[model samples]
Target: MSDIGPESAAGKRTLRRALLATRNGLTADDVRESAVALAARTLALPEVAGARTVAAYVSVGAEPGTLALLDALRARGVRVLLPALLPDNDLDWGEYAGEGSLARVRHGGRTALSEPAGERLGPDAVTGADVVLLPGLAVDGRGLRLGRGGGSYDRVLARLERAGTRPALLVLLYDGEVVAHVPGEPHDRPVDAVVTPSGTRRFR
Candidate 1:
């Protein structure tokens, strides 16, 4: 991993590269197995179990998979909201009906993403969620998350704060991504908990 800490943009970029490299090393089978375990563990969380609506994203590439959990939540009659990336990099949400309800979307030159094909719910739709699942490379003991530096979720967090919404914020990760510390900024907000394949950890 790069020697750069997580504070500076360069440092965060370095950390993100290192983390992506690590994730890239995992095989397809390994990711599937981990995804199953992650879903089981995440489903057991009280917050998730009690949530009637969840704001989450689809996993592309080697990111900890959310398909199983998303389906499970939907089966339980929970309203699942999936994000659609806007041209400006902000996210617009749509309801997740099922695997068939998602469409492959390519934003600019970036990798194609699986987004909801249903009605556009607008960005503020996230504020109505009981739980929000954030995508991250790593999270510290203090619950600070190291994202991919896209600034999309940053905007989501900011919007939630401005609306005075206090939904339970959670991140799904592999066990190895739980580090002792990560870079933090004034706009960076700490998550309420993290769910890994092994278990879930909460922070104050």
Candidate 2:
């Protein structure tokens, strides 16, 4: 784990803002093209290809899209799990049936999200996953991810740690979102790899 200093928080916030701004600047067509490229790269990862079960999320708006990848995984007979946000911001799990199985959900003061409209699986269901696909604003060379400040995935990571489950963690992002450094804290666990539109970067 990387050491966190007094400046880490401010630096993280600044980087988050910059990354969000850049993502917002992308046109719809640009996001679509990137999503296609990202899905191909992510699907080629050995971790994803070998996993029997994967916990992934539906990409909203400017985030690197995941609908195509989710469907592809389902067609491959991989059990795909999607997240449903809980009242406290922790995520609940559900099976991804297909594009039609998702419902548009709007949380308070947040952008609308597409979530699975299936049976609700307990949060611990993620423990059974062989690989977990995480959403993030950016990821540094060290594999520290900068999330959207929701802290939802933080709870998910904490739950996995408590259960001693060691699943391969991955983040999908645009080529530019991979950076040299990301301000990280002790609770922030590094990911095993990042799949971007251009390629994948693995961390030790």
Off by over 4 Å in 1: 1-7
Question: RMSD to the native, candidate 1?
Answer: 2.8
TM-score of each: 0.95, 0.96
Give lDDT tens digits, candidate 1, residues 1-204.
223344467667778898999999999998999999999998888888999999999999999999999999999999999999998889999999999999999988899999999899999999999999999999988898999888999999999999999999999999999997786777888999999998889996
Candidate 2 lDDT over 41-110, as tens digits, reads 9888888889999999999889999988998999999999999999999999999999999999999988
Ten residues in sequence with the least summed lDDT for candidate 1: 1-10
Instruction: Give one clash count per candidate, in the order shown.
Output: 0, 0
* Model 2 misplaced stretches (Cα beyond 4 Å): 1-6
